[model samples]
Target: MKQVLTIAGSDSGGGAGIQADIKTFQELDVFGTSVITAVTAQNTRGVIDVAPVPIENIEKQLQAVGDDFDIAAVKTGMLFDAVTIRTVADSIKHYNWQRLVVDPVMIAKGGASLLKEEAKDSLIKHLLPLATLVTPNIPEAEALSGIQIYNEQTRRMAAEQILKSGAQGVLIKGGHGADPDFTEDFYLDQHGGSLVLRSSRIQTKHTHGTGCTFSAALAAEFAKGKSIEEAFLTAKQFIQSAIEHSLNIGAGHGPTNHSAYRHYAQKEMIRYVH
Candidate 1:
């Protein structure tokens, strides 16, 4: 079986971060491994507290995973500060690992800051260059590119600037946009080609871990030997189904159902055959 690694924080709620990543990996039929950089005391409602792991321990975990598993792809979720970002970059370089997916998780669903303001520069400088694909939401894209994303023109401009940061590609997620009907995610490939993935908006509040799950599914598909475009499409479909069949476990924002994608695909196949 193929293996993938998630270097991110642990979400105690099992709705986002490492928990969501692992769940998505499992549902996608990949061996899931992780290096927890921090632990959040959070649930559906909000993040009560966060404790960042020590740099030394984080390095040790990465080295351990590298030594044991042949990680086919890797994804990052929340590196709390600049030091952790630098350490993670150095570790990835040392491991000589490619197929890196960087999910620039800056804020939580409850408006809590996951990435420190000071560490944004470190992420762009130390990590973006190493990323095979950097997945950023609108606000994140705006912050990374130092521009406002209002429409297609500005969104494309932000994507271009982010690619100039040395990332091979960028996916600007349109979840935060003002689209009333469809959520459009824009993808800019390394060769300057672009693809737009559109899915009808699901009116629900159970989108706590959408970003983490999308990047995780993307990495899992890559580990399974799918092409970048193929993996991106599968990831989009996965997230869409997961959102449409969201779970209702928490009082606040719940999590998307990771297993819903496989079921949805099976049903679609059956419908197609009939």
Candidate 2:
């Protein structure tokens, strides 16, 4: 089986962060490993408090993972501070891990800051250059690229700027935009090739872990030897199914059902194979 790593925060909520990533990896049939950067006192409601793991321990976790497993791909989410970001970058370089997916997780659905303000520059400087693909939402893209993404032209501009920052590719998620009909995610690869994936918007409050799930699904697909475009489409479909079958549990933004895609895929296969 393929192995994948998630270097991210631990969401006590089990709705996002490492919890969500692991669930995603497991459902996608990849061996999942994790290195917790921060522990957030959170639930479906909001992030109450965050305690960042020490840099030394963070390095040790990376060392342990790199020493044993052959990680096929890795995704990063919620690196709390500049120190954490730098440490993760150094560890990735040390391992020489190339299939890196950088999910620039900035804010939670409840409006809590996951990435520190001071850490943004460090992420851009240290991590972005090493990323195989950087997945940023509209706000994150605006912050990283200094381009306000009001429409397609500006989204393209923001993605181009992020690509120039050193990542081989940029996927700007358009979920936060004012578009009421479709949730369109824009993609731009290193060679300037672009693709836009459009999906019908699911109106619901349970869109909490959608980003994490999407990136994790993409990593899982990549580990299974899918092309970037193929992985992108698979991940897009996964998120759509997950959202459609969202778990209506928590008070605030709940979680997307990770197993929803598994069931959907099985049904799809059965229908086609029959």
Give the best candidate by lDDT. 1
Candidate 2 clashes: the total is 0
* lDDT of model 2, residue 57: 94
Lowest summed lDDT window (length 10), candidate 2 = 265-274
Question: Candidate 2 lDDT, tens digit per residue, 1-274?
Answer: 9999999999888988999899999988999999999999988888899999988999999999999999999999989899989999999998988689999999988888888899999999999999989999899999999988898899999999999879999999878989898778888988888888777788999988888989988888888888888888888888889888878988988988989987875212111100
Clashing pairs in 2: none
Ten-residue region with minimum lDDT total, candidate 1:
265-274
- What's the lDDT for residue 124 in model 2? 94
Which residue runs does candidate 2 get wrong by more than 4 Å? 265-274
lDDT (Cα, tens digit) per residue for candidate 1, span 1-274: 9999999999999989999999999999999999999999999999999999999999899999999999999999999999999999998999988899999999999999999999999999999999999999999999999999999999999999999989999999989999888788888876788888777888999999999999999999988889877888889888989988877879999988988987876212111100
RMSD of each: 3.6, 3.8
